[model samples]
Target: MQTADALQLLLTPDDDAEPVLIDGLSIGAAARADTTDRKKDVTLEHFWDETGDPDDLEEQRWGVIAPEGAAGDRLIALIQPLIDARREAQGGHEVMIDRVPSAMSPEEAARWRKQHFDVSVELARDLPRYQLILGDLNEVPLALQQHQATDGFVGRLCFREERAYEAYVDKVLRWERARAEAAGGARFFTVHDRTAATTIGYRSLVQPAVAQLGRYKLDVADLGDQDEPSPDAFLEAVKRREPTVLFSISHGAGAPRGGWKTEGDQRDRQGAMSFGRDKLSGGDLGDAPFLPGGIWFMLACYGAGTPDVSAYWHWLERLKQSGHFGGQTQSVLAGLPQGDQRPFIARLPQTVLANPNGPLAVMGHVDLAWTYSFQERDTGRAMSRPSKFVEVVRATLETSRVGSSFRELLKASIVTNVELTSLYDDAERLGATPDPARLGHLWMLRQDLSGYVLLGDPAVRLPAMRRRLKKDAASAGEPGVRVHEVRAQAPLPAVGPAVAAERQAEDAPKLPPDMDIDDVERAIGKLLSGSPIKAVASEHDIEPKQLSALKEIYRKAGRAALGVK
Candidate 1:
């Protein structure tokens, strides 16, 4: 065997950038069971209606479904731009969910699908895929974005309530339009809470990912240091700044057994990112939101709603097969008979997107959040993995595809990990030396891959780059504030932006309690007038430049106060 291929079988625990399919579905999905034909006589139009009239299947592919509801009605209008784009690209082999009974047996009901549909064995990045799943959170299939279901599917871009749905969708459309014509930074805000065990990796992974995004020329703001002033202060910061992208890493509030399906529980727990031990739930934002429409990627447990049982049943079984079970079942595979095993309440993303002033979209963990999505263990060191979230953003901004490329990449990562465990199980039986790294990596990768979900529309396009006045190269680098270009190159490419400078965590800045410019200036004036620059800096416990700036500002204040103008 080739050394690289052999190394992967034992240690790397990832497919060498090549996609592997077992039976149209991923190898892990295929291993669970045979195709059962759950729904009978499927067609290209299951998600759309063709009876209204059409020219060709291509033209007809642009489904304009009017699902009834104030929010649903608004969703259609907001996504009309995407629909029109799809209608324009209506040629070549398209993807649709349908059954080819001929492949299985000749006796199945004489196939009612009027048009010929070929089931492609590949995950389509550009297929105009969509599903308008109406009903409660439990009624819908959370795996609507799962990789195994990528046969003819992608993210459903679900709308739970017509009101919030309309509000967010319209907000997205307006943000895109306004951004394209105006000069503005695509600011991305990442808030982290470092106090919990679930979030101990703040320094290791979360902060690094934030820096990486900043290098993408996204005006990135990271607000999750250990000495955070207060929850109110953090919340106030979020309200004060209008960023284009918001990414958070922390503990999400969750429902215990009693409150699992309650409205209050759903509103408070499912999407709220931790503020130390507490959280700021969607309801906390109140009716008038300070967020002015943009994308939000929240890395907390159940930031998106839990998926239907179908998403994780096979995965659970695989774990059980490999001699692991119980907790994984209770946490990840929880389901109810009526809801196809999906969670019973709408998540924080639902509320965030539904707000008339909330985000355009949100991507988050549907169940448990994990460090594996951002970092991996390598030779005793925790290394930053190529972020799956970064891939999702690329697919989102660059490709006009229907489903999440986020789910697809994560699936590949999971399948590779799962395959290793199965290999280890076989090795244990055969007395072959087992690679422990593969098994360790497996558990980390599985929950991460299955749990992430993109809420709001997957088809929502980022704002086009507005023309900007370029600063001279010498002054281009914003001081202290580091922002790299995030727009796919020409500037960044289809992937994420260039790697950022590794940010070393330093002790929090010790500023005065009552921060007044005038007070700072007085201190600067008193120290500098009687002492050297170093002495002034030492007395203020600040840098020389900082003292100098303060002195300059204080002198300017003195002139203004004296009415020298």
Candidate 2:
């Protein structure tokens, strides 16, 4: 067969074909050992059951975690109207908003999170469940957002200027106040990259999610297949007022085969959605009415933005060492923020949010995204677990808050963390090494889960829900749809320090009480000079785990401070 024909056949659509489960052969002996769970309880419903209806703002307070100093003050002032609206919605209650002094970058955010929430994330009850971050990734940091998301319904509001922020707030308020009407169904737009990731997402997630949404009596405009995923079609779909939710899957643009030329060029083009030979850049949308007042769930690498350092950088490096997907790995490497190019939110999302007619929220990945997120190997068998992905679609179509819907995806990560913690505790107790296979699997899952974030207000829901509620209210002869009022619950008692300390010691040990950033740097230098983890820990009067954790924290902080990844 011709090479072109062979490639086409391999990429042929097979709705009934089972997904490829096993990822690849192990790279080393350490990776061959298995210590993780065979079947992770990665269902989205479990998280919803535990967290309750985060969509109901009447019962849950909305919070904003703003940046510190003058910039934060200016941002808060720009969105003061939004705070007032949410407060009125909550029956004149104060919103839980605060500024963090040390969370401007991922490294600083990590330290802040470690100091506040610790390893296991448990938010104080008095704090709001629905949290909004009010700055760009560069201004507020992805680390702080991820930590808050571990337990709360969190989203962000980051735009290029004060006018854009004001415009977004206006767009959201107008969307909510507009009269409700029956709307078009959800739109499922997907790209056929011919790679396994896109193929499996199409077969497993797109097709299935479309079908499932139909079952919910929601209208769905299925825009999968070859010809429909172009930039023009995407724009047309966005132009229509109905279908307030667009769920798309695509390969985020990385680099030209030769690699990027300059940092400016890379930042401008990276993370654009690949539509065959055609691509969709944020600039392509202009100031046009794109997804006006709608919400989008974009599944692609850096669909949100590039982080300072990809969590999967070392893992992918190991894969490359094993001689796996060398070209693809290089492409991803080239796409990452390299050499003094500070992490920033993607241009597409930034432009869209800035546009007066753009989406209310854009849910996407902050780093390299792999099939590892939705596809998992089960007992030596590869399986597609699209439940979590599909649930987000369902929740959005059902008019749930975008942040709450994204939490459906976060549940899978939470499950993996529990399994990982269990494995670690077992290994520590039995003096046995955890299975390398299990460890790698759970680690990837956890990282992938943490990468998906919301880029808008956490409290915004689809306009379709508003129409439905209004329609119901009219039929019942009521003044309007009455939102049931509920009192804010008192703060829950924190976990006792003894238990918290014991858990911290078992996993990532806390830094020595007196050690500061400079002390951490010196300790890291000692470890780099061939000192064993035990020796370094002994010298610092800390556990080996503590030393290792401190080294990572210090390294990330130092690199970021030096304007390098």
Candidate 3:
């Protein structure tokens, strides 16, 4: 409502600062659909034409629409009034209408241009407000026409599709609707108020509490740009300062030449891949420095994809091990279509920044899809909206009652569930039998118990399988299936020949009178560095305390000691 409030809402969590939801459409789905004649275009058109008129509608509402025909008029009618109402409710605070383009056809283009002018006139004639038209008008005819009508109009528009348009509308309207409801004495929307009070303006969709979280913008280095920042430069930037969230929209490769290609054949028609190496190897992520204390939203494919070898490490794994990020840092909302990165990149920052804490959950496709199958979970809700994901994250974060390591872990679980679903779909297509061992272990690690309910198939009792796994582990006298024991490796401290010989002498069975206490300590230190003190003391028939005290002396001398850091 206030200038400060508007400014705060404008600051998003991601770097792109683009709206996640535009004109009530989900950018991710729209981008995916743009690649193919998928549900994005069809659904958008249906919603726009079939849905009720925004001007005639009374309830505080939001919906998606096609850019053609009367759909744009309905959206304009619906959104402009909400914006006006928000301004009035906020004590004459001016509302801003930011329009993003959603169509490219000449006919559709003209329609969009007309819609904008009509909406602008409505705003000017009805309410005291300001509007900012952003994004490209893809249709050349409309651009030319609009340019002829008003100077600089072409420059003000961006050619982004309808998905972005609808998403922005939804966010703005929802925010304003919430504000209007909160301030109730003089209703912003009433049957009697026809002209001045009839219009509703932009509302702040971001929750007041959640809006306080730190915001950031995620601008990925363009790999194709000759002047673009190198991986090292990017790493250095990250090392100097870390954001609460990192959203990367760079290109990614899968495994090496011999490994399976998850998306498509990387090789061109001439059998040449973009990168020099064979298979699905990624660009030089290993060389990049990671932000230790932040969450990474990898928009790249295979950034978290598993490696080919059994024990070999992947880039995500290495990043996780580098101590720059938590266990969840390696986690990603992957499998998104390459084209959809722009919309995701634009909206993610705002969604994350709008939350009181960092995003408690991140959801992404394992593979690109024109239709967002994930949204089936929330039926009747606007499928194209960005606020859907925002709502899920908000609810998840609130369940924590604040924040905790467990909550972060829960966030990881939800992200993993989404990834697993995508993987399940992929595996089904590839005809790979679901590995019960892997599935069981993953189920055990899941922090959200409700996830088990979503497993859908009762045939695979993950809990029972995990129990069997535990029994096998106990019988084999090894760590359980889900646990991995990594032996620590580092060079031993250098000791002189005389010191080593003294240590050997101390180690040799000798009477107490000949034993040098310092030499005994050095020998104990060297032994403890490699083996546990309990094992060493028990094997050599010495008190654990004596072994501990001796080891402490060497530790004081700057020698290496092994244990948890």
The prediction achieving the highest TM-score against the true structure is: 2
Residue lDDT tens for model 1, 1-565: 2211110100000111111110111113223321122122122223323242111224234223233355445555666555544443343233232312211121122222123232342422323344333334433334333422333223445554555555655675565445343222333333433232223345544555555454443444556445552457555544633435555555555544333564444444554555544566666666555444556666665566654343335655665566543233443322222332335334466666776666666666665455555555423444656455555543433322324444455555555544655665687689885454544454445546666655554444444431222234554475644458776546433221111111111222434453444435544655554545653343233567877765665554445445453
Once fitted onto the true fold, the runs of candidate 3 whose alpha carbons sit more than 4 angstroms away are 1-237, 241-243, 249-283, 286-288, 306-565
Candidate 1 matches the true fold with a TM-score of 0.54
Off by over 4 Å in 1: 1-137, 148-153, 180-199, 214-218, 229-231, 240-243, 256-268, 287-290, 308-345, 378-381, 390-437, 466-565
How many pairs of residues in model 2 come into backbone collision? 6
Model-by-model lDDT, in order?
0.44, 0.67, 0.27
Q: Give the winner by lDDT.
A: 2
Cα deviation of 243 in candidate 2 (Å)? 4.5
Q: Candidate 2's residue-wise lDDT over 1-565, tens digit each?
A: 2211111111111111211111322323124322333333222212223544355454567878888899999999999999988876654568877777633444565456556433333444445778888887667777778867777788888776689899889988887766436554688887765555577677767776765555454577788557445677777778876537888887777666666787777677778777756767786768888887778888877788888887756655666666643334544556667766677788899889788778889998888776667666523444667889878877776566788888889888887778877887798899997777667666766777788999999888777632221123323434432456589999766545544444444665455554444435555776766555654453333567877877776565555445456
Prediction 3 global C-alpha lDDT: 0.27
**Pairs that collide, model 2:** 21-382, 33-435, 33-436, 34-435, 35-435, 185-219
What tens-digit string does per-residue lDDT give for candidate 3 at 80-104?
Answer: 5444543443234344333334534
**Best first by TM-score, ranked:** 2, 1, 3
